[model samples]
Target chain A: MNLPAGETRELLAAEYVLGTLPPTARRRVERWILLHPELAESVRRWEHDFARLAALATPEPPPARCRRRLENFLKNERPRRRLTLIAASFWRYAAPLAVAASLFLVVVLVERVRTVERPPAGIAVLVGRHGHARWVLTMGHDRMHVVVVGRIALPPHKSYELWFEPRAGAPMIPVGLLPNRGLMTARLPAAVYVRLAHAHLLAVSLEPAGGSPTGRPTGPVLATATPQAV
Target chain B: MASPPEPALPSPPPEGRSEDPLAAAFLACRRQDPRGLEKLYELLAPQLFGFLRRMLPRKDLAEEALQDTFVNIWRRIEGYDGARGEIRTWIFAIAHHRAVDILRRERRLVPTPDTDLESLLATAPPETAHEPLAQLEETRLRDCLGRLSQDQRRVLFLAYYHDRTQEEIARRLGSPLGTVKSWMRRGLLGLRRCLETP
Candidate 1:
């Protein structure tokens, strides 16, 4: 059963502050807190309450190797381009943010592919309702990769399904559920469309079973994309 | 002759930390100052590291995860919204998740001994331990902790140290999720009540 609005939120927020909420539950509540300011305020009160509990633990020094590894990682992380600043004219700024977001996951995914040694795969971009990338997809014969770097707004009672609209001669297949955080990769069928400009459309359909049913999209189209050349 | 000169003293309000320069600096780095991120790191490293050390079984893993946590914090500072949670909570949440993720990935169990309450007593630094009165307070606090039900303390410790999700804690303790959650809420409230009653 779903929880009621405020009182239950406080109870859960306290548990979250106490560091007792389940990971899934915590993720859910965190999303809710992001949307609702009041719930977040409840969390703040509890955060201060249990904040001192850490004092009870004895400090353990880390091994020197770990620090060195982290230092190296930091030194190596190339800073990506950030979104442009806001100004009196949001209209002037909107397109750039959308364009930057479109390339974001592709940039990260491409970089990761080079260093991490993943296989050549098929990719699809899941754009937000307004044409920003809610996620990006890269599918291999056995693994599906989805990177949700941009803002994704899912309906409360439903979820967005990722569908591979293969060419008229091919078939549509289910990939996997999209996450709210960093990049994700899972197993998939194979590369169906090489050039996004030429082949099947990657589309979002709101549906049940945590994904699309009836083998076709059933909800308002959120976003679609073509492949980017590596 | 004239009215007595007003006393020239304006003491800062005791509870008013309104101008949290540190938080302000975090906000600034969040806005534009890159050094602000490093300053935040310097401020928060101990708390983050100390918390992680308690949760992980080994030091190396904890430290590795802590580094990732800080790196993410530096990179994702703009995503931090002060309105949602405590800056401390937000920072630790990242650290906590990294620790949990590492544990899940490695599939390792945290090693914790059956600690005796008295054995846990840490005599503070000489400056504080030198004072018999401070020692007395520490003794009293330990005694108060000792009075807590084992379940209560376990829940409290698990929450504080491991930052386990309620589901994980419940599964580990073999208690219902609701029971585990309420224990964290009321049990912590009880501890506070007990500690504050001078």
Candidate 2:
């Protein structure tokens, strides 16, 4: 039943407790319970109101070890929520970069496939919002992998270049050059986090050819991102 | 496991306005008494386990869920408030939900051939050869269950203890999800009334 605001959560929570809510709708209520403390309370109420009859079921105590295992499980949910929150907040700033990786990886895959149908284990193609692949896959093999970052609509004098993001610890590695067709691949020591199937982001930038002398991307690059989750 | 001799039996009439010492201790322990929680556990764990075993057909699952139930009860105690109802009711709610969550996550259900008939029965527990809690008047429970219509009772059972989602229940009963819903809502009310009667 579509509950009214005045409907007191008693009914909604009760029905929910009853499992009378369909799976999809119940998911919504379950989420709702997490977000709305009041609804959770109502559930607690209905739970107690009828718990007694369970008495009819007859008592069967769990072994002590079962109780100990339960303690560990309860602990798991607490950290699970905290970790989810950490991932959520990190994405606020990191999301745009994640998007760039997808575009870059896809372009590489398309061009490689156009020439050779084999996709190096993983691929990402970077595209312009206008539907153009600016970067294409080139080197990803059993050893070193490279992507051609090109056709980037850049300012007249600026060249686009590629940068590799690592899972952790390593600083962003500056790879090869972006010619006017703007193609560059860093023959990474290991695959970029992006090419290996899972990583945060890979980026492209507007730099003068031969990459940054300082080994970093330069210029107010038009756009960038981490590759896709293959 | 001796029933800690009902030292000072608080006259157990459907717990009224009068604070049930056990309920009070339950609430107090929930508020902060670590020992109170232990006392409450000792007082109620066996009873709750009995409740869960029938709700869950499998012994191992019942035992696992039983442990999970008390752990959650310990964790969620702070969320309970008396205004909603009695403390025991709150604990039962936790136990029921925790059990339901387990059954759903495992994708299992109480074995019933055709859960549709008004006569659908719970997979009865093994012949209680040991018949634990036989003195607890298993007859009264059987009588109370008898008072319920088969359909009403089935709705109650599935809601409290299984993987049957609302849509599944509706589909299984050959009724719309809405009908299944109302049957549950109205069934709970009927159960509440039945339990509360003098």
Candidate 3:
């Protein structure tokens, strides 16, 4: 027996707002809310109703120092945020220069590697549904390089996150977020390096900006690749 | 045709109107104004703290949740969509979520005496209270909640007020987990049907 989709969604939404859903399930529901506006509305309505019920708890004034602590936090946080904004602006201006430099570096690296023909530790070419290579990942001794091959149509407010599945039906461990364009280089974490040796497949999923919130993929798997040892 | 009338004096906001007083302060906080955060803290801290104190067993834990909730409100204010709900709901949701997180981490129960179920069933808002519409809504909710079976009501209240998981509620009531889940589902459906009645 199965519940109608709407009823099931409503129940899930209620449970989500009630704080009854387990942590992983809760994260899944949050992602569902993002993908489904109706679910979001249902969750919001439940939140409003429960918030009203929560108001039934008698109101007792918090100690005065709580206020002082918050004020102090804000005082410290403001300058830090301002500094972050300044750094953001610096990135805004430096982005084009950095892109140019990276492009040049890519060209030089690709040529030198082709001539040297040194076997990469491992390599994988992630392909889209059409079987066209979308990204090429190469694991060197200590660094992993992910380079977008062509114009990949990326959804707005979404990023492509990479993961290494150690074996069939095993927990997928997050490797890194893939760039929409150009190249991303990161020093391989020891765990990732160890997993790469036995990884069954490499996968990419569409996630919100900055990557998966739940430490697991919560969106559609857009591409996948199998590592080949040279 | 007549002489200019005297300038209209500013009148106080209407009584009994359900208006969001925190909306302006929320907007300012979104813009990173420290003063706006101060105003919000002044307005909401007491009520939020009170709610947290009830949710968490210890004063320090509740206070910790309160601070984290405010910091999250300021940082994630951009995520709040005015079209979806009120600022107050968003704020309370953050606070409630934080409290639940702490509750799960602590895994300790607050000491709630065996409450008189009859009193809760008979609960009604005081007529003298302001915000009649809100009071009416609360009354309707309470009435509907009262109608649920005692077990169902207890399960719902355990989850809602005490942040108890279904497993915990089951253990606490000596009921099977499946039974507790059914009670919760049926309780929720019944409440929804009652509240949705025009």
| Best candidate, lDDT | 3
Report lDDT (Cα) of residue A105, candidate 1.
60
Give the poorly placed runs of model 2, Cα more than 4 Å off: A1-13, A23-45, A61-230, B1-34, B108-145, B170-198
Ranking by DockQ: 3, 2, 1
Model 1 alpha-carbon drift over 4 Å, by segment: A1-9, A18-38, A60-74, A77-80, A83-230, B1-38, B108-147, B163-185, B191-198
Q: After superposition, how far is residue B92 of candidate 1 from its true place, in Å?
A: 2.1
B38-142 in candidate 2: lDDT tens per residue?
666666777787777656657687787777666666665554445455556666767777776666665644453322223223434323333233323344345
Which runs in model 3 stand beyond 4 Å of their true positions?
Answer: A1-3, A22-31, A79-94, A97-230, B1-20, B108-134
Q: Per-prediction DockQ scores?
A: 0.18, 0.21, 0.25
Candidate with better DockQ, 2 vs 3: 3
Q: Write one digit per residue (lDDT tens) for candidate 1, span A13-122.
A: 77766645555566566545534657767777566445444433444445556556655765676553443233325425544665576566667777866533454344
Cα TM-score of candidate 3: 0.62
lDDT per residue (tens digit) for residues A65-127 in model 3: 888889889878853354226757555654444445444545645764553233346667676
RMSD of 1: 17.1
Interface DockQ of candidate 2: 0.21
Question: Each candidate's iRMS in angstroms?
Answer: 18.7, 18.9, 17.3
Root-mean-square deviation of each candidate, in angstroms?
17.1, 20.3, 15.1
**Candidate 3 colliding pairs:** none
Q: What are the per-residue Cα lDDT tens digits for candidate 2 across A22-117?
A: 545555565455346577676765555455455455456667876566546545534223222676755554455545655556565466545443
Measured by DockQ, the strongest candidate is 3
Worst-scoring 10-residue span by lDDT in model 2 chain A:
A188-197
Compute each candidate's TM-score over C-alphas: 0.51, 0.43, 0.62
